[model samples]
Structure formats: structure tokens, C-alpha cells
Target: MSRLITLVTAMIATITTPALSQTCPPPLNGAVRLVLVTAPDMESTGGLLQLFARETPAHAWTPASTPHPVRLGKHGLAWGIAFEAYKRGDEREKTEGDKCTPAGFFRIGPSFGFVASERHNYITIKPGETVCVEDPASPLYNTITQRVQLAPETKADNMADTSLFRNGLFVDYPSDRANKRGSCIFIHIWKTPDTPTSGCVALPEPQVKALQQFAEGGAVLAVIPQTARDRFPTCLPDMSAPHDP
Candidate 1:
């Protein structure tokens, strides 16, 4: 009888333990929904200066892997982030180049992508869509754009400039250092499930999975330079006001 009771207790423990351990709890307690950027210096991380929403203290909730030096947009004027989340190819070392990414803030967004695993998602952009790249007259020039092909290498031809656009993040060229710098920057997914990017930051599969859960239109990401964090204001009202034409 005692052996029978022990066996039953063992079975119950096994069943209950597995279920209890597998469940993921909500985000860390009181972890404000703000985007946090980290630099190689470690302490330099946490440049959470931008305000994402008006109602909540959080400006945005970005993955822990989002890159630094967030950029802000100029004209279209919405909060945005520029990250090294996606790379052009499988080579991880490609991200080492200095010119691979833009430095300052730019208007970003209008989330795009098909659903992946409900916990992993990404925005898709082609190679020649003509996103803004700081060009003066190119309509959508100086803004985010997508191109139709992958840039084999970075050069005067493949660089993020005014001629091309990638279907990812928008570019905002401040007047101080303006030019037709071409575009095709993206806020897409990593090359591999566990891979990092060339010039964009990477989010865990789970965070992106939460994208669809947020309210639309009012969402925006603010990317800025490491220096800009201290200079710019923290938190802003939802700039995506309703359009009335």
C-alpha cells in the first residue's frame, strides 16, 4: 500500500512540475515599457530619453538587443528607431564597417511583415522601393525606402543614400549634414534565428511576436545618437494624430 501511494505521489509531482515551470511570466515587474539601448561601454547603455506614448511612462518597449544611436525623423515627424536588427547577408563580420548604418534619428514605421510563430515577426522590404535617403527633390527622398536587390557590398553604389529605399526604417536627414545619401535601411529580422546583424539590433523572437498586440497608428520608435539621449527630451505625446483631409 505504501509503495502504491509513493508511486501516485511521484506521478503527480512530475505532471505538476512540468506545467508550472514551462509557463513564462509577464515582463519583469514595473519594467516600464521604454526602449533601452546599450553600448559597448555597458554603462553607456540605457539611453532611454525618447517618449513613446502620452498615456504611459514608456516611450516604447524594444528588445534588449536594439542598437544604439537612435535616429529621429525631420519632416514627417514621428518617433522612430534605427537599429542593426537585420543584415544583408549571412556574413556576420559585414557589420564591422562604419558607414553601414545611419547615425541620427529618422521618422520610422508603419509596421510591415507577415506573421511568424506568433512570437517571431519581421518587416519585409525589397531593394528598390525608394525610401527617403536625404535627397532634396525625390518626393519620398530623404525618407525611408526599400530597394529590390541585396547590396553585395558597401560602396558609393550600395550605400544607404537618396537613390534607393529599403522597406524598413525611414530616414530623416537633418539639414546640417544633408545630401542624397540613398536609402534601403531596414528594421527587419536577423539573418538567422540566433544571429545578430550587420548594422541593426536584434529582438528576441518573443518581443516581436508581441507587435500585433499593440495599438496601430499611434506606434512609433525613436532612434537617436548616443549623444542625443541627453540633449533630446524624454517622452513625447503620441504624434500620430488622426488625419483629417
Candidate 2:
């Protein structure tokens, strides 16, 4: 009787240990939806981006849409200070005007566009009417503000003059409200496959349109570096699980 009990216990442990070890990491907790952006390396400006959705946190991510080719920052990627870093005191590897795309998990914020009646979720913009605050000395640094809100002499980038800002979604980096980690990170329209952005991710216009239709508020965009791809399962285990029949 004692031998039989030991055998049964060993079998149970074998069955359950692997499953529990494969649980999703903290970054993905409570995220029922996500967008994964992957590059070949920290220096590669081109890569594939895909959107995924799940019915619940415990379930696997299903392909919500097709993968889109995208462009990253001109200088490549660097680690940005986000929620996880804020708690742990990780050093920020990127700075303002570094021209490097930030690699981390960021919440998706409001969309902005030039057309008032555009078929997407975005704030309307008139030429020279919108600006994103990049001045660290100002209280609104790293935020998007209307031109009317600023003094005439205040330094800010004109979002309208650039065709890229005609339609775009905000990426909420620097999750800490009080500190300025980086500014004006966005997913916007790309000029061409060969052209890299200042620090934002760029997609072709048609894919940008598709993204506008697919993305929802409160979703997270996770930028994972290629060198770390092997460890991705430890961070997002649902993606590794076998599909349900």
C-alpha cells in the first residue's frame, strides 16, 4: 500500500509541475490583449509586428490580425524605463533625441489624426495646431498638448507638419507620471520601408488603418528584442502552449 501511494504521488507531480512552471510572467498578468513587436536585434530598424487577443488571462493569444512589416527608430532600440523598471530601479538605456526605439511593455494611448471625421479612433488635428511637449523644464514634458495651451516662446514639436503624424497611436512609455523617460513615442504611418523613424514605430498606411480598427483602449504593446526571443516563453507562456482542439 505504501509503495502504491508513492508511485501515484510521483505521477501527479510529473503531470502538474511542467504546467505551473509555464505560467505567464508578471508583465503579461491581466493583459487579455496585446501587440507584439519583434526586431532582429537592437540595431535592426525593420521587423514584424503582430496583434493578438485572448478571451481571458489564462487562455492563449489568438492571432487577431495578420503580421505587419514595420520600421523602428533610426538608431535602433534601447531599454526604456517603464512600470517594471520604475519599481526595480533599472537604468534607462535611452534618452530624449536618441533616435532609438524603446524596448519594453507600454500601454496604448489615444490616437491622433488630421481628419476630423476619419474612420479611426483619434483626436483631430489642424495644421500647426498640435504639439507634443519635449521640454523637460516644463510641467507638461513628455505629454501631448494643444498649441493654444503653450506660450508662444515655448519649445515643442509641430505634429501636423510631418505626414507621419497625420494618423498615429500614442505609446505610453515613462509610465511614471513625474519623471520624463522619453517623449513622443508613437505607432504611425511610415514614409517608406527604407526610412526609419526618430524613435517611434512606423507601419505602412494600410496596416495603420487596420491597426486603428483592431486596437482597443487599455491594450499593451510589448516590444521584445530578438536576442531575448528564446526567453519570451518565460514571459508570455500562453504563446507557447499547444492550441486547444
Candidate 3:
């Protein structure tokens, strides 16, 4: 009986050991499960600079506030920067020193597209201006306005936008919050290879394809901060920073 018991124990250990060893590894290449970032960044640029994880899309995006995590656009990448909170007409007043990007999540695409500037092709928003949701009458009224747009030839090259955004993807802004403050936020290819976006996330075609692979149904762009990640289970830590873990 003792010998039989020993044999059974050994078999059980062997089976269990392999199962435990096969746990999923950390996100590949420190890839972010979601986008989180500051308020100002979110408003100025459609891309979120931070990251997070959640079962549902986030309604609010804040640098210091982590919301839920959702996949990004097939050709979309998020922007990075912490700015201060300020109303429209305050663009000059708000600076990198303030570290604000608003604090809310907005629905994303439903029509995204790429623009042909005659000279080159660029990713364009859903036409019209993107404004703060709270602020009506903005060019992007009833949609995302006052936001910035990065053309394929300007800069903010990530390689993904040029290849993937050849056709462009629809954008769905999160529900609620200020919009119409600006418009035309996008991630497109650029002339300068090393140029950063006015405030949009930029990527190459391969990255966009990778994004589509992960996003099953669809995806959302959540912008928050590293500190916010600690507050919410859905929120992910900021990994875009230099030498992040």
C-alpha cells in the first residue's frame, strides 16, 4: 500500500507541475492592455498615453485616474504627456507644466478615414472638428472636437499608421465628458520619421495589424496615469515611459 501511494503522489506532482509552469507570461514587449493618460492629453489628442485593464470601456480618462482597458484602433496609437486641466480658449494657458488631459472617457469611432493631401496620404478624422462634449457649437459638435490631427507627412511616425491607415478606421468617442473643444485627431504616417504627433498616437502598419489581432469585438482608448492604475483593477501601469518595468 505504501508503495502504491508513493507512485500516485509522484504522478500527481508531475501533472500539476507542468500546468503551473504554463502560466501566461507578462504582456509581450511590455505591451499595454489599454490606454491611460492625462486629461489635457486626451482632449488635445485622441490617443491615450496611459494604460489599464477592464471588462468594459472607460467613460472617463485622466492621467492620474485609471479607467477600464479596451483594445485600440487597428491603426491607432495613443499620445503621451501630462498637461493641466483648462477650458477652451485656454490652450495657450495650459502647458506641459500643468499636466492635464481632462478626466473622462469618450466613445470611439463608428467612421475613420485617411486623407489624400494631394502631395501625400494622411489619416484624417471623421471630418469636421472634434470639440469638448460639454461645449456645444464647437466645430466637432455632437462629436469629438478641438482635438489635434497628425498627418502622415508631418511627423509622429509609428509606421503602423501609413500601412494600416491607408483606408482609415472609424472612431467612437467614449460617452460623456467635454468634446467639441477641438477636432481632427488621428494617427497617420508622416514625412519626418522621428517626428512626434501634435497630440495623436502614431504607429506603423504592422502595429495596427497587431492591434486588430487582439481586439476581438472592438476596442476603446482610455487615457490615465500610473497612479490611476493603482486605484482601479482595470487600470494598467504606464509602460510607455523610458525604461519602464
Candidate 4:
């Protein structure tokens, strides 16, 4: 009996060990709220964006808002660093300065903007003080911190640009300084419908303001390109289908 038990234990471990190293997209984990962003193709500079919600963790996602237009990275989308997509062929992995929006699952905000948002833990950007670090060499790389925390020469995006970031939401994207797998991503106000971002998603002011509701609760952001859409079809809405009016 002891030997039989030992054999079964070893068999279970052997069966599950290799699964640990496999790089698949993260599970939805019954997220009640989601923000879906999908591009038509890998090179698309703009795509459809929408909000999905459910009554409970066990409920299916329903479109909370109409699919709206939004701007993507000038270089379009790439598989995120955490995503080692199998059989990817020539599809690029996100890297620093790629100008491509990192496409994969990400946690949404701790909502931010220029003014104090009454929603929840709103981050009020202070001009010349608050910044998002972009210098890969610095310890503060890919992190949000005050300008005073770094040496005068460090490269960071000043979050106080009211023209662009008057209303913004921080995207909790995983940072990889050693590999330089992109950094400083966010969802914010756009300069125009035609303009693209360095790597963040952008929308007009009104569209972005609608996202603040998730600041109190939590939300997941799914940025997937059309090439990989079927990979996780069960959790995503069909962008190709005509949405209800």
C-alpha cells in the first residue's frame, strides 16, 4: 500500500511539473469587471474598446458600454513580456521603445488624473513632482514616483501633462528592466483621434471618464490583437460581430 501511494504521488508531480514552465495567458479568475481592447491586426494603430461587467464573480460578462474608438501605439500591438506565445513565428515580444502596446492581460487602475477624483484612491498628478520612470538603469525603472526621488538626469514621463493626461488610469503592466520588456503604460486622454501613443492606450476625455467606476472596485484590462483573438475566445467578446444598439 505504501509503495502504491508513493508511485501515485510521483506520477502526479511528473504530470504537473512541465505545466509550470508553460507560458499561457493568465486566467480571468472570475473577474466581474473587464476592459477589452482589441485591434483589427497587429499593425492597427486604432481599435475598438469597451467595458464589460457582471453582477457577481460567477456571472458572465455583459457589455457595460458601447464599443468605442481608441488610439493604440504607433507601432501597434505585441505579445507582452510575460507571454511566451507558442508557435508565435515572427510575432514580436514587447520590448523597451518598441512603440507597440503590450498585448495581454493586465490589472487596471488606482485611477489617476490632474485633479482629485472623488471615486477612490485617486492619484492627483503634481506638476514637476509626480512622474513615471522610464530609465531602465535606475532602481525606480517602470515605477511611479516623485521627481525628487531620482537624480536630475533620470528619464521619466511627467504625469502632469494636463493636455494629454488630465484623466488617466494606471495600467499595472509587469516590468522587466533586465530584459527591457517595455515600461510606463497607461490609459489616458488623447491628443486627437488620429494620433497614437508611445505605448499606452488613449481615448477622448469622455470615454476615459467612464472608466473611473472601476477605480473603486477592480478591473482587468485585456489587450489582444486579432491574430491572437481565438486563443482566449471564451473570455472575450466577439469584436467582429456587430454589437447591439
Candidate 5:
């Protein structure tokens, strides 16, 4: 009987080991700078955003900026189009019109603002020219294009919306139009402290500008819900730390 029990125990462990080890790891990809966002769960419309930086992969992530309150998608978060979570078919994937912000690591880059930068690929949102195509059926979906160049029927964000996007960083979410994973995700200004966004992360005007200055072209952003935060890398900062500005 003792021998039989031992055999059964060993079999159980073998069967469950793979499941236990399959926890999705943070896909930082050697990022030296990071913007980490976390919410309570899939239905939360707000969360905390913090920044961390390191010299290299071997260096520890030190706090770059203190935690700040940010408004999230009205419907909460879903697994992003990138990384293991969506590929494994284990979580709800972010899709077009889901009203949920995508959770994953993404690159931050070339800014968009009222003024253009001759030194960088910074987009200058011209009132009549700029538009971000959100229509999945359009061949130019997910791209920023000129209104005069696109079909007159194309549906897109004006991009010149000074109210919400006077200045912001484009979150390089790997959403494909064919997949209709999602589109137009960004870290722009919020309308109010308590207002929720339509699938993008929204911050205060100052923070949005500061983030653009800090991003420096290749910063990675990780958006994880509280339940899954522990599985990611250990760069998460302690919220209790006294560093708010």
C-alpha cells in the first residue's frame, strides 16, 4: 500500500508540474527603462503607473519616477496582442472596441504633439492632415495617414484632437488590423481625474509630457493586472515608498 501511494503521488506531481511552471513571465526583452501599470482586475477602470530604470539587463531596476494615479479603459484590461498570454489561448485577448486596455510590454516612441520636432520623427498633428485609421477594413488601418490621401470614407481618429492629444507618447502595441486585435492605444491626457478612457491609458497633462521626455525612444511598458503581477519580473516598485512628487 505504501509503494502504491508513492507511485500515485509521483504521477500527480508529474501531471501538474507543467501547469505550475507555465506562468507567463514578463516580456521585458532587456529593456533598460519601463513604465509599469497595474489594476485590481479585468474590470477596473483605473490604476497606478510607475517608472523604473536600469543601466542594463544585469542592473537592478531603480525607481525612475514615483507612482501616479492614472485612468484606464472603462471596461478594464485584457491580454495584449503580444507575448505568451494571448498566444497560449489562456486569457481574454484585447480586441477592437473592447474598451479594455491591453496588458503587455510595448515600446514607447516618436512623440506626437502640437509642435513638430525637426530632430526626430515626432508627429505634428496638423488639423486637416493627420488621422489614425481605426477601420479594420481599410487597407491603411492602424496607420497615421493624411486625410487627403485616404479614401473619403475611411474612419479614423482626427489625431488633431488638441483636447485629448495635445501631447503624448505612442504606445507601440503590436495590434494587427487583420486580427482586429485593437488600435490607437496611447498615453495621452485625461479629461478629468476620475474619467475613464476608451481603451487607452490617460494621465495628467504634466505627466504625459514628462513621460515623453523620459521615454528616449526605446522604453518598454508593462501593463499587468494585480492578480498576474507576481508572475512578471521583479522590477515592480513598492507603492509605499515615499517618493511622490
Candidate 6:
């Protein structure tokens, strides 16, 4: 009887280990809310983004909402200064105008939209007047501010009239002051299912709105490549290679 019990216990452990390993990792910083974005592969610009909720840190993550289809950068995935940089060497690091979406964990920044929502923390954009500063030399670099607030000589990308910026969630990238890490990363409305973005993650307007409604304080976003999903947050990229310029 003792031998049977031991064998059964070992069998249960063996069966459950792989299953547990396949579950999505916990939200960063112990956040109860998470947005999980998973692509088919590192080079694919299309994927699924899902919102997850956990009652407590000890509980497993459960889907808070349906999976939403999303479009990524035209050039696909690349390393960024945020979560990826810590895991992988900067060999394939993203740079300004690289057109590759930075893949890693991120804290969802302030929500913005042309229309206002009282439920979420939203920043309203003034068409033709709002701009997201991408110029590295400017004090407002990698930030969204009113054109009036910028220095007279500062050059910035006007985001006021763009549909992509009409409704969006900023992904905190280039968390440091270094200019080479890239800028203006966001999750925004896509033009179409076939359309890809400059670097932001794009979803339909309805989906974007849904995300805005579901996301709350202490939310985190984790972009996981399909190839790395199983081994993520554990098997990091090789760090020996020199960083890209």
C-alpha cells in the first residue's frame, strides 16, 4: 500500500509539472491585472492580446475578457530597454524609426483618447495641437505634450489628427533617458486587420476601448513571443552579442 501511494504521488507530480509550466507567468510587480500579448513568432506582426485578472497573488490568472486580435510593428519584434534589455543583450535592440515593436513586460501608462471616459485615467488629445515628442534632443523627448508646452524651436510629431492616436494606451518604453531605446510606443486603434503599425500594437477601436475599460491601476502588459512563451521570464536572450546601433 505504501509503494502504491508513492508511485501515485510521483505520477501526479510528473503529470502536473508540464501543465503548470505552460501557464502564463505572474504579472510583474505582483499586479493583479495583466494584459498578455502573444505573437505567433518573433517575426510576425499579428497576434492575440488578452486581459487577465487574479483575485490575489496566490491565485492563478484567469481571463478577464475575450482575446483581441492585434497588429504589431511592420518589421516585427525587437529588443527594447524595458524588460527585454534586462534579459537579453542589446544586439537587436530597437532604435528610433526601426518600425519594430519592442517585446517585453511593460507598465501600462496613461490612457488617451479623442473622446473622454470618466472610468479610466485618460488624457484628451487636441486635434492638430497635440504632439508626441520623438526628437531625442528635446526635454520632452519620448513624451506626449501640448505643442504650446514645447519650446518654440522644438520639433515633434503631430499626433492630433491621426486615427491611431485617437484612442490609445501608452506602453512605457525607453524607461531610461537614453535616446537610442526608441519612443512613442503605444497600443492603439489599427486601420484594418491587414494594416501594420510603425511600432505600436494596433487593435480595432472597439477592442482598444474594451481594453481601456478593463485596465485599471497596477496593470502590466507582457508581450510574449510564441517561441518564447513556454520558456519566458526564465530563458532570456543571449547577452554576449554586441548591441545594435
Most accurate candidate by TM-score: 4
Alpha-carbon local distance difference test for all models: 0.31, 0.71, 0.33, 0.79, 0.77, 0.72
Clashes of 4: 0
Query: Per the 3 Å backbone cut-off, how many clashing residue pairs does candidate 3 have?
Result: 82
Give candidate 5 misplaced runs (Cα > 4 Å): 1-27, 84-91, 233-245
- Name the best candidate (by lDDT): 4
lDDT agreement of model 1 with the native = 0.31
lDDT of 1 at 79: 17
lDDT of 2 by residue, 1-245 (tens): 99999999999987866542255444466676687888876777777788888787656677776666788888877777743342223323667778888887777777778877554456776777788887766677777888888877777888888888777788877633345456878899998888898989898887876676666445778776666556546554223221101
lDDT of 5 by residue, 1-245 (tens): 99999999999987865531133344474677888887876668888898888787545678888788888888888888755443333556889999988887787767788777652677888998988888998887777778987888888889886578898878878788888988888889998988898998899999988888788657888887776656554545455322111
Q: Model 6, stretches more than 4 Å misplaced?
A: 1-27, 84-91, 177-179, 233-245
Q: Which should have the higher TM-score, number 2 or number 5?
A: 5
How would you encode candidate 4's per-residue C-alpha lDDT over 128-179 as one tens digit per residue? Answer: 9999999988899988889999999999988886578888888888879999
Give me candidate 1's TM-score against the actual structure: 0.36
Ranked candidates, highest TM-score first: 4, 5, 2, 6, 3, 1
Candidate 2's TM-score: 0.79
Of 2 and 5, the candidate ranking higher by lDDT: 5
lDDT of 3 by residue, 170-223 (tens): 334322213223233333332233434443434444443344333323444444
The collision pairs in model 2 are: none
Clashes of each: 52, 0, 82, 0, 0, 0
Q: What's the candidate order when arranged by decreasing lDDT?
A: 4, 5, 6, 2, 3, 1
Q: lDDT (0-100) at residue 163 of candidate 3?
A: 40
TM for every model, in the order presented, reads 0.36, 0.79, 0.37, 0.84, 0.82, 0.78
Clashes of 2: 0
